[model samples]
Target: MKTWIVLLASTLVLPAHASNHITDSEKKTPLQVETIAQFNGIPWGLVLLDNQTAIVAIKNGAAYRVNLATRMTTRLTGLPNVDNRGQGGLLDVAIPPIANTQNWLYFTYAKPTSEGSTTALGRAKLDNNHLSDWQDVLVTNAVVSGTKHYGSRITFDNKGHVFFSIGDRGERDLAQDLSNHAGSIIRLRLDGSVPSDNPFVSDANSRNEIWSYGHRNPQGIYYDAKTDTLWSNEHGPRGGDEINLIRAGGNYGWPIVSYGKEYWGPSIGDGAEKEGIDNPEVVFTPSIAPGSLLRYKSSNASDWNGDFISPALALRHLNRVSINQDGEYTETRYLEDLNERLRSIAQDDTGVLYIGTDSGKLLKVTLNGS
Candidate 1:
């Protein structure tokens, strides 16, 4: 028989005053420990796949599969060669809709280029303990000269087409260039082809794959189950981290006009509000260095009905932002005690919450709250 431990948060605070953001009796404890893999560095991406397999991304161009029941980690193959410099490497992964029918698993990484470095998407079929028939799915149009700011986060729409977040590639002006795919959200077909219905497909001045533009280095993307909406969290320069409601062809202002300041303590742009540029739904003042995003199941959440929980690398905690029926949000921070720089979060169909930490710990947190 397997043993189970139950832990509840109970923090004691001053009786004179209290705050709405934090409860006086809030806490969390580790229920179980299963150290599947210990890397020399941080783990990048993690998501639970169907049929008892889970996917993970390691920084140095490696991806693996873990069996939750058996705690068996089998390193899969076919990841792109990445420089693994300051902030560029194998970034994020997603299993396309074709995975069910076509057996295709998609991933993104930095491809070494002559000019500098470029981010590219690759797809491979997960066969018996390995990836076979790998294909380079998509490569961004803009050529990057640096190893930083390659936004390779990939998510799929309900239509079976794909949506990817491309970073500004360290060049602020490229974010405003409609002709460039960098610093934009792109929509593409499953076979590395452009979608005809993309936001800027017909405009001669705009790249056809551009779904939305003006993002910095966005790492997280999610399709909301409750609202059927696309949501993302992007990192800010000094401060001013953002959580955005991703819309087709929406232009989210980056260095053109950000809520953050420059490294020299100067204004990033004219101001936060600029004409025709979309404001973030939420912005962080102190800067959380946000990572990947995952929504929570109400069945396991105690007070929150259903909330979008984003991981923070700088703060090393998870942010739980709640949404109304209409998709408007009210925010709360959950699982502060995890004290781990959570890189990714995924839930199994059975309500087991799996979180990947920067220190290479893959945690399965099962909630039992009344």
Candidate 2:
């Protein structure tokens, strides 16, 4: 359930630019943003297939194949009917490498269950317009008793294997449980099997699919093009949102070690800076509630060169960081004044940028300098 527990600061009017525009109430900037297409439901995922084509996944259990040049959108068929209640709904989507040869697409959805709903990640092919040859790739192991915190985001590595993020399922202790997949990073074969090289393949205290553990609800999972390192943005309780560098068998320490406290305003473990718990590369004391991640290589916009971009939903700003060698980052730039919940970020092969908003709008941000 969406709560009005926030009061965003008003944005100041900036010079006319492609990244932002001044609005009246200032409550919604990108809501009226111009784009080639729009979303029919709560947007969760976005990706650029190429220069002219892009894909957007919505909570309405639909994914839209978009053409940027023509300003047209085509709804891809054969998506699952999701349990769209509370925060449980259709989630992350990705076009895997096999999609090139087989038109295969991977997606995750909230599968209805008697206890509640368990988040499931599945892979299937798009047979000319229909989803054909469907296969169940993976399902979260923990029992879901609540409709909140179903963290289901998917990505692929250089080896072409799949790495998915499963939320803690609102049961904090489950994150520390090795038998459960909840609140951990799961790495799997493209055909949906646990790989042999996994950290806990034969461990009695861990699930084979788990790459890392102790995460609350991570929304962004991206692989760096050069380093091949994975980066994720995890949502903290109230504040304490984090940008983490994920490693094989690393423990992120959610309820055990956190930058923020419990939602009821109690202390969450030791603190932000602890010894055993891996600290975040950067922490958002007042949470920005990051939803999507896009690593820029070449210039996506006029001002932004190659950098890691995280769109802030609760903060309504885009924070850009310069990646350094020692696995650290410096705040390089910030795209401010967009007062809307940024849902996703994508840049086509040609380098044009597109930002999707939760308010049913798609924004095309470019450079206006001549």
Candidate 3:
């Protein structure tokens, strides 16, 4: 095992520009980082079963139970066949918060279809080293030609609903279409049933599972039960990656309105803002390429309580954003020295953080003074 002790100094505060009375404060936290385990493939999803154990999902359609103390891994079985093409494969895994449903493990992966590949949600019970009662809960209607935009991640709300994201599947106009599940966040009951209170449940033309529309590729979705807030971070073409406060029935303008420029050096969409579209709480220009999101609540490290953290792929850092009561944000970037494409993040009961990197390294980060 290798270890590194680093002190991270907070960066300059950037104005959120959404609301007033945003305060800027500087924080200096000493970190103890340890490379707990290594893999041959990217660690796409990570969830802690307990303080000493965790379940990790690899991008190559493999899952493992990892021991945090000994750095040992046990392979898990019974996952459905996933299309490991382009950016599609085994993705996020999450455990529901409710006590009655806590035994079931939820997952999102790229399911291969006759037409192509689409994002799918599934659930299973962990029986020793293997999965039992494996079932595909929802096979999204997002099949298209390319595999680059399967923006899938799982999170559960305080209510009995599960939410997951799907990218535009490389088709830009599909984000605005209500008939398909592409480029949208989907909400469903724990048993794969559609909730009647969903935004488009009554619209025959729209998919009943849709919670919100017009998202490009939201790779990360986190629901904070304490604040009752849903947060998402998505990728943009060249610039304009966004961190949005997700709202039910709200439209987040994507192709029709974007702060990003086209790959061929042209402005995208009608403009950056439109009347009915909801604006993002934070926008990262030049694309940090956030792969996952977490609303960190640390009892051990009180300074980090209620902060939002995401792993940056393009910039290779741990991105942290502090949101004040007035909805203002102060941003900070950490761990650039590691130079790994951080993909997923999770926190333990004692407030220790586990980060999954694209380089197949599982990192454990702890606040030194805590």
TM-scores for every predicted model? 0.87, 0.85, 0.95
Model 3: residues with Cα > 4 Å off, grouped in runs: 7-10, 17-28
Candidate 1 local lDDT, 1-370, one digit each (tens) = 2325433432322221121233434454444433555555556777667737788887778888888778777788666577688677777778764435467777877877788777788888778668888888777776777777887678876677877788898898899899887898777888878877888878999889888889998888877656788888888888778878888888898877888788779888878868988878777766878888766664544654466676778877666666554535555554555577877777665566677788888776655542
- Name model 1 segments beyond 4 Å from true: 1-36, 298-305, 325-329
Which scores higher on lDDT, 1 or 2?
A: 1
RMSD of each: 4.4, 6.9, 2.7
Backbone clash total for model 2 is: 0
Off by over 4 Å in 2: 1-33, 98-101, 299-305, 326-328, 332-336, 368-370
- TM value for model 1: 0.87
What's the distance in Å from true for residue 26, model 1?
5.7
Clashing pairs in 1: 9-27
Q: Candidate 2's residue-wise lDDT over 40-150, tens digit each?
A: 786777776677777778887888888877878888787777778876787887877443547777888887877778778887776645677777787677657687778
lDDT of 2 at 319: 61
